[model samples]
Target: MEAGEHQAVQLCLESGALISTQQHDLSTPVHLACAQGAMDIVRLMFSRQPDQRGASMNATDKEGRTVILLAAARGAWKTVTALLRLDADLSVKDNLRRNLLHHIVLSGGLLDDFHGEINERLKDFGDLLNERDIQGCTAMHYASRNGQLKTIESLLHFGAIVNLKNNENQSPLHFAARYGRYNTVRHLLESKKGHLIINEMDGEGKTPLHIASQNGHTRVVHLLLVKGALLHRDHKGRTPLHYAVTNGFTHTMEQLLAVHSHLLDQSDRDGNTALHLAAMHNKANTASLLLSLSCKISHNEQDFTPIDYALHYKHSEVAMVMVTHPSRSEEVMSCRTKRYTCLVEGLTAVMPEVMMVKHSFQALQNTEGVGDIVPETDQPLPVMNIMVRYGREELLSHPLCVKYLETKWNSYGMYFHMLNLAVYTVFLSFLTTNAVQLMAEKTDRENFTQVTSAQLASAFVYPSTRAKYFLDIMNVLEWTLYISAGLMAAGHLSTAVVDRSNQYIMAALAVFLAWFNYLLYLQRFNRIGLYVVMFLEILSTLLKVMFVFSVLIIAFGLSFHILLAKIDMNVKTPVFDPFTGNVTMRSMNMSDKGFHNPVISLVRVGTMMLGELDFLGTYLRPMRALESSAWYQIVAATWFLVVFIVLMPILLMNLLIGLAVGDIETVRRNAQLKRLTMQVELHTDLERKLPRRILTMVDKTEVYVYPNQKGSSSYVSVPDTKHVFRVHSSYVLRD
Candidate 1:
C-alpha cells in the first residue's frame, strides 16, 4: 500500500467489513478524494466521520499543500465544491505560499462544458482573490504567464493590482509582452485599472521595449509604442533603435523608423552609426536604406569610414555608391593612379582562352545578314560549254570531263559531277594504265548483280561507268546536306542574337536542332557513311550545349569577378612602376591548370555516346519494343499521338486536383488552431474577476455552488467471490 492509500474508517462501512485501522502517512481519505475530484467517495467518507471533517479539510500534504489548494491546482472543481461545502479553509497557503485563486489561475481554471457552471463556482469562492504567494506574485501573474487574457481581465475587474511588481520587479504587463501575447497586452491596456504600459525595468535594467526588441517581437513593440511606453535609454545608454539594429530585428527596425527617423543617425558609444554597422555586416539593402535617409558619418573614426569599411570587406556595389558621392569625388580622383595600378593587377587573374573565345563569338554575331540563293537555270549545261564559258578551257585535256560529256546526259549527271573531279586528279597521275577498264563500264544497271559482290564494289576506275553512277548519287546527297546544314547554322546564329532577350525560345530551338540532326543522320545507310553523319551530329549537339553553358557561366561569374576585382583595386596598393610590375609578373609561374574531375570527363563521354545512339536510332525503328505493331507506325506518323491517345492529360488533371485539395486542408487546420487559442485567452480574462464578485456577496450565506467537471469517468468495485460460487452451484443442481 502506498503512503496515502490507508484504510479509512468510512471505507470499512462501504465494503461491509471492519478492516484494521491504518493512518495515512501525509493525507487522509478526504484529502486524496478532494484533490482528484472523487466527489462520491468524499461525500460517503465525510457522512461517516462528521466530526473528523473539519480537521481533514484543513490537513496539509507532504509538500505542505492544502487539499483545497491541490484540488484547485489540478482543476478538480467538483471536489473543491464538496470540500468547501464541508466548510474547508480557503485562506490556507501551499509550501510555495500560493493560494487557491493563484493555483486556479495557473491551471487555466477547470475545464467546463457549460460556461454557466464555471461562473457559479467562481461566484462561491471570490474572497480568496487578493491573496499573494510567497514570491509576491498575485493570481494575475499566473494568468498573464499562461496567456489567459479573460482571467487577467477578471482579476483586474476584481480589484487585483495589474501593475504590481513581483520579486524580479517585473509586472504582469512585462510577462504579457515578453511571451508575445498581443491580444492579452491589448486587453490589459484597455482595462482602466491596468497600467497602460508598464515601463518597469527588470533586474538587468532592461525595459519592456528592450526585451521586445531582443526577442524580435515587432507587434509587441508596436503595441507598446502605441500605448505611450517610453523608448527610453537604459543604463547602457542604448535606445530601442540601437537594440533593434544590433540584434538584426529588421521588422522591428522598420516599425521604429516609421515613427522616429532621427534615430537612424544615432551612434553607439563606439561612435559608429547604424549605416556603419549595416555595412560591416554586409547588409546591402539596410545600408542603402540608411544612406538614403542621409545618416551622418563620423569623419574622425579610425579606418572605419563607411566607404573604407565596404571596400575592405569587398562590397563593391555599396563602396561604389559611397566613393562616387559628390562630396567624396576629390578623394576618389586622388586615388585614380592607384586604381589604374589595381586594375592592371586584376586583369592578370583571368584565363586567356576564356577571354579569346568570348571576343571571337562577339565578333561573329556582329556581322550583317545575307538572303538565300536561288538556282538560275533548270536545264543541264554541256560540260565543254560550262568549262569554256566559266573561263576554264583546260576541260578538253581533262579526260574525266571528256568522258562525262561523251556519255549521254541521264540522272547520272549529278554523280558524274562529283566523280569527274576525283578522276581528273587520278588520271593525271596514271594516264596510260587504265584506259581500257574506264571505257568498258555501263552506267544504267538497276539492281546490278555480280558473281562476287566485293569484286564489283572494289572496282574503282574513275570516269568509268560504275564510278560515274556512284558520283551522281553523292552529288545529289551533297546538295541536300548543304541545304539542311545551312538552315541549322542560320537557326543557331539567330538564337545567339535573340538569347540575350529571351532564354526560353533559345532552349526550345536547341532541342529542335537536336531532333533535326537525328533525322538527317537516319537518311545515310552505309556504316562508314553513318559514322561520318554521326560525327557531324555530335559536333552540332556539343556546340549547342557549350553555347548555353558558357553563357550561364559568364553571366554569373563575370559579375562576381568584376565586383571582386574592383574592390581589390580600390583597397590595395595605390600604384607601382610599370617596369617593376612586368618583372614581378614574369617571376611567377602561373600555367598548367585544367579541370581534373573524373565525373566531368565521364559525363562528356556519355553525352557523345547518347548523341551517336540518337543519330543511329533515327533511321532504324524499334518496332519490337512496342506493345502493338500498329503503335510503331502510328508513332512514326505523328509524334504527339502516343501521349494524347493514352489519357495522360486526364491523369495530370486529377493529380493537380489532389494537390489543391491538400493545400486547402492545411489552411483550414491553421485557422482552427488560431481560433481555439483566442477563445482560451478570452475565457481566462473572464474567470479572474469571479473571485472579487464572491467577496462582495459575503453577507449572503445561501451561496449556490455549481461544480463543472470536464473529463470522462469510469467506476470499479470488488465482487464477492463466495456468493458467486454459491449461485453457480445452485444453478447446476437445478439443471
Candidate 2:
C-alpha cells in the first residue's frame, strides 16, 4: 500500500487532470506512482491507461523534483528504471540543482560497476555521472562520501568531474578523505587528471589533509601527505596540524608531526603556530602531544596568546597549555572609496536616447498626426504603439515631407495697414467733395454770404491736413492690398508645392486681386465717376464669382483692337475692292448714309480724313458725329442718371455725414477743455482763498507784523483795516 490514502490521492489526481489526460502539475499516473514508490500501483495504472505513462516524463513534481529524482531518492530502482525507459530526462535538476543522479548518489544504494544488467538497463548512467547538484557538487562527491567505491568508479569512468567542489568548496576527494573513505579516495586519486587533487581546499581554506586531520582519518591524511599535499594555512592562517590538534585528532596530529615535526613550531601568515591553535581549541591531549615536540614560548610576542584566546573563550584548561607558547602578531590593511563614479558614466551613455524619447512625447501631446512621433530607438513596443495609434500604411505613404512649408500669410501690421487705408480713403473723398462744393457756392451770384462762406471754408481748408489724411489712407490701402495679394499668391504657391497642382489656387488669387482693384475704384470715384466705376465693379465681381474666361476674352479683344489701330498707316493694304474693281464701296456707302462707325471704323475714317481736312475740322467732325450717334445718346442718358441720381446722392450723404461727424468732434473737444479749465479754477480757489479765510477766522482777527531793520518798513502784515480799497470803482466799470 502507498503511504498516502488511495481515495484522497485518486481525487487529487482526477481533480488536477488536463487535456490529453495530463494532470494540472504536468504529471501522469506513472509519475505519481513512481514518485510514491508504489511499484504494483504503477504497473496497475500503466496497464489500465498505457497512454498516461508516456505523458511529459520530464515534468517536475510540486517540489520541482522530477518523478525520476523522487524514485531515485526512494531506492525504487525498478520505478526509476521504468521512468528512464520512458525518456525521463536524467539531467533535469530541481530548483536546488538536485538531479536524479544527486538523489541516487544520496540514497545509500550499493551500486555495482561491472554489473551488465545494471549497465544495460541504465543507459543514462553517464548522464547522471556528469550532473551537478546544488552547491555545485556532483554525484561523485556524494558517492565518495558514503564509501561507495563501485559507484565512484562508475561515475569517474563516465566522466564524472572528480575535482568538483560543493558549497563548502570541498572536492569529492576532500569529502572522501573527511569521511575516512580510503577506498573511494584511492579510486579518485587513481582516476585524477592534471591539477585535480593538488591545491583543492574547502570552505575553511583547508586542503584535503586538513579535512582528514580534523575528522581523525589517519590513513587518508597519510595518503594525502604522501601525494605531496601542501601543509598550507587556511583563511585563519591555521595549518592541518592546527586543525588536527584543535579537533582532538591525536593520531592525525601524530601522522602530520611524524612527516614534519618542524611544522608544529612553524607559524602561519598571522604568526600563530599549530600549538597556539590547538591550545585555543581546548584540545589538551593534542596540545600535549605537540608540546612534546620541543615547542617554545616567546615572551615578547606572547601578548593575547592562545592561552589568552582560550581563556577569553572560556576554555581555561586549554588556556594553560596555550600560555606555554605563543607567536608574533601581524596587521592587515583595508581600502575603500565613497564616491560613485560609475553612475555618472551610465547616465551619460543613455542621455541621448532619453532626450529623444522625451521630445517625441512632448511633440505627440501637441499635434494630431501619428507620423509626428519620430523614430527614436529600435525598441519594437514604442514603434508599434506609434504605428497603431497613427495608421501605419498612411504614415508610411506620403509621410509629412512638407512639414516646414509656411502657413502664416499675414502679420498684425497687415491689419493695421488696412485700417489706415480705409480711414485715409474716406477722408480724401470728403475733402475733394467739400472743395468742389466751396468753389460752386462762390460762383453762384444769387447766393448771399457766398464770399464770407468761401473765406470761412478756405480758412478751415488746411490742404496739408487733407494731403496728410489722403496719404495715410493711401498708405494703409496700398499696403493692405499688396500684403493680401502677396499672401494669397504665397499660400497658393505653398499649397501647390505640397500638392503639386496650382490650378484652383491661381484662379482664386486672380479673383482676389481683381476684387481688391474694384474696391479701390469705388473709393476713388464719387458722383461723376460712377458710370466708369460701376462698369469696372460689375466686371470684377463677374470675374471673381462667375466667368473669368469671358472677362479675359473681352479684355483681350479691346487690347487687340487698340493695338492694331496704333500701328503706322504708311504701310497699307489695297483700298480698291478686288471683286468690284473700285474703291471699297462699303466705306463710301457708310459715309454717304452718314452712319458713323464704332471706334475701330472711326479710327479708319480719321486716317483717311487726317490730310483731307484741317486738324480743327477733323476733330470737330468726329466729335459731332460721336455726339449725334444713337449709341452716344443711350450712353449719355445712362451716364447722366447714374452720375446725377444714384451716385450723387450717395456721395452727398457721405459728405454730409463727414461734416456732421467733424462738427460733433469739435464740439466734444471744446466741451472737454472748458470742463478742465473750470475744475482747475475751483481747485485753485479752494487751495488759496478758502484756507486763508478759515485761518483768519480761527485767529479771531488778530494780526502779526515784522519790520525790516535796514529800511524800517513792514514787509509782512495781517489785515487790521475794517474796509478794503478796490483798484477801480464798480460804478465806473459799469458806465
lDDT of candidate 2 over 1-735, digit per residue (tens) = 246456655555556543124367755555667767776666555555556554545556666776777787778887776665556666677887887767877887555522454466456666667566667788888888899887776766666777867778888888888799987777777675625675577888888777888889999888877877887778877778877877898888889989987776777666777766765677867766665666653211444344434434455344333322222111000101112233122222432221111112223223234344644332212332454345443231211100100000021212322444455444333333332443342322222133223323432322223344346553455444444333333332344432323423432443454345445434322222333334443444444532433342343234323322222212122366679788642221123211133344433333322222132322323333443343344344334334433322354435434544445544443333222222222222222333445433432211111111123221111123212211211111221
- Point to the candidate with the largest lDDT: 2
* Alpha-carbon lDDT of model 1: 0.48
Put down candidate 1 lDDT per residue, 1-735, tens digits, no spaces.
123333553556567532222245576656666666777766666667666666667778776767777788788877766566656676788888888778878877733321343355565445666666788778887787778867776676656777777888777777877787788777877777445445778766677777787666899899888887776766666677766666566788888888877788776556667766665666655665565656665531453555445555565444434433435433432332222343212222221111111111122112222111112232123223333345453433232332232221222322433354344333222221221222333221211122112112222332223234445543344334333323322333455543322423332343344344334333222233333443444444456655654443343233322221111111121344687673222211101111123334234223332232232122123222334544344244234223322322244335434544445534333333222222222222222323545423421212111111123111111123232111111111111
In model 2, state the lDDT of residue 123. Answer: 62
- Candidate 2 at residue 67, lDDT? 70
The Cα local distance difference test for each model comes to 0.48, 0.49
**Candidate 1 minimal-lDDT segment of 10 residues:** 586-595
The ten-residue window of minimal lDDT in model 2 covers: 400-409
Prediction 2 TM-score vs. true:
0.39
